[model samples]
Target: MVLHVFHGAGYERERVYAARVMFEEFLGLEIALHAGQEAGWRIVRGEEEDGKELRLADVLFRTPQGEWLTEKAMPSRPVPRWHTGGHPVKAPLVAPDVPVLYGEEVPNGGYLAVWDGGLQIGADLLGGAFWMLTRYEEIVRKERDVRGRYPAFASLAVQEHFYERPVVNEYLEILWWALRALWPDLERKKRRFTPRLSHDVDWPLMGAGRPFFQTVKRAAGDALRRRSAQAAVRRLGGWWRAAAHGDYDGDPYNTFDHLMEWSEQQGLRSAFYLIADHSGAGEVDGDYSLEEPWVRRLMRRIKERGHEIGLHPSYETYRDPRRLRREFDRLRLVCAEEGIEQERWGGRQHFLRWEAPGTWQAWEEAGLDYDSTLSFAERPGFRCGVCYEYPVFNLLTGEELKLRERPLIVMEQTVLHRQYLGLDPWEAWVLIDRLRTRCRLFDGEFSMLWHNSQLVDQGETDLYRRLVETM
Candidate 1:
């Protein structure tokens, strides 16, 4: 099978080259070149056309008798071996310098190992010569040092890619090539990847029917209706409390009774995040020391109603590591008094204020199981730059921490935020639908955030609940 590398949208060519180098080193092998191009190889046609376009990588040899040939192509293959041997790869090792601009953190240095803005070179074209050489050296060392056991595979088990929007096609081709070289049998047997639809909603009935004319007609009607209602609401004001929860306001959703009732109806164990002293003035303190009886009653009722309680780790705590520890300490004590033995497993930073590496360190130190504050409210996409929850290395200590980050892909304010795409609830929902299309690209979890206060009945919050109900 021919290998192909497809980069994601808008990936820079230089970055692609760098990624190729890393991959080649991880896998110990020489990529056969297309005869004509001479610059890099690409597998175009069949074996006869090999070396012509530098099309495909030479991963294995197969004889006419259907027996697999060794890399050395001996009459009889030697017994299969593990890794060809090598030393453990250290962090911050940069590939040979090219003209490309690197991100602030060196490879494996910064909080994020992969940023989406990197470039991509065709897998067979630019090739991965440098990386292959490094791996070979490492392999030879392993063979010399270890008395027994070679690496089962020549390269790293996992591969990572970071690219922009436009070059995803090229990225895919490169992935196909890499997979072929690393796992020939697995690659040949597996089917190509396809995006899947995740969220469920009524579309055709909600005026999303066919034809350009129909969409335009419905959009115009919606615009007019919205404008008339906005004008009437401007003339007569209602409760403006909901709008105040923007940035400074904390724990503004006082609808504990309503939430408890709704959660019971749905049989969902919902978690309510409470900010400690940072909560707005006049709000009751629910910490361990001054456990107000009413607040305890609310927590008890919530438990009885089959919901969960969590802390909305305040924004200030993210920078001050101590704050995070203390806040979690207080939360645990409160939960203890309530006799809830199950340790809390959820966290979302207040205001989404976070530094990736620091936030992770804080979470690890606090013994938190998951952090759900990775996404930004201004952008409705992968905030940690990765779509899945995988154990990440600590940027400061280079330790592989065990905490998981559940990326929040969508948030209410993210849609209405004026800085980026200023989409109303309806507009935001449309964007969310587009994100849903991307979710099918991988099996990663799709996380969404909506504050309880944002759903309150107010002119500004007119369409928030409707959008949520649609979800």
Candidate 2:
């Protein structure tokens, strides 16, 4: 079935393309866009006509003097502070006739107006989805944290207190209901939702690449920080065991074997993003070389065990195509030398440093199949306003990139690190469960990033084990 959309003449090409993606690719609809007026279902930028016309348009679209409806138009509306299943939402639709997923009370004139014959939503869902899917706020909001990363607080979702909610999915649901009401034969693609577990091996080994003095210094620092001589002694003993006996089972950061065993027992597969290049000073890349014998052996073992050995592009290559190509090429060469043949490869950016179309362009040029780096460093939630994996689009050029973005829902550091939420293991598990439920509700993939180094800690490791078992 073809759903014709009649849009205003002044609409931007990028916005139109984004709407097409949301409707066609995401919402599973065949859409045909028309410049002016059309016959069937219509979407206009003005007041609705008094007739049996099935139309959907936001009141902001009727702006007498603006290029298009934007966040500026939202201020005039009664911004209601609302929550849906513990996820914050703003400007909720509250028309008594319109069925809302979650809200407080039905307002006199809700954002969405439903009737027996037609429906009219007072908000531009297409534009809103475009703004979020393209990361428009990141480009417009010129605020960055110490690491030159966009802080979650600086995001429109956070400012509007909806950071934890997947508003795009909510909008899609609204659209789905409206369309189904208008056309009962509408069909949608369905898939089983599951967690896509991944690990970023930022520090593969704590003592393998460090100097002897540095190892001792680390032990001393641990002793002082933890206020326990026993912890220091254990650290030194683990180093000695790894160095002399080639045993790393006791090493705090050496949890590869444990992870493999746990995954096997739980009947789940995971991807390990191995660092391909070393970083310069003031970077967060791994210290050990990818060519190290132990590293190569681990890669081979991971491949043999049916787990993926993906590349973890260094911090410096986040935006540099040349650097990213060099790193990816080196990783491919190493994998080839190890006799590992991967049909397609995927990975995430080190430190999660990404810069819009440039980063997507670099990944496309480098020929990476997919990337899972679109999550907040300071908070664990839906970063792209959705929970599903979708192909990325270059917001500037209005071209779809070859790379698929597996939206990351949670990262271990974002939840437990002192610099982030600093939640205890139980609290973190609760938050993870909540996010996972949202993914399940939408039949979306729940992508998670758990660093291999974090597994060395007993509490963190136990939490991961429990999560896998429950899943």
Off by over 4 Å in 1: 1-252, 256-269, 279-290, 417-421, 458-471
Q: Which TM-score value belongs to model 1? A: 0.48
Per residue, candidate 2 scores C-alpha lDDT tens digits across 369-393 of: 9999999899888778888777787
- Candidate 1 differs from the real structure by a C-alpha RMSD in angstroms, to one decimal, of 19.4
**Once superposed on the true structure, which residue ranges of model 2 sit more than 4 Å away at CA?**
37-54, 58-108, 208-210, 225-231
Q: In each prediction, how many residue pairs overlap at the backbone (N, C-alpha, C within less than 3 A)?
A: 52, 0
TM-score of each: 0.48, 0.86
lDDT of 1 by residue, 200-267 (tens): 11010111112334434444554575444432332122212223322212222344555445444544
* Model 2: lDDT of residue 329: 94
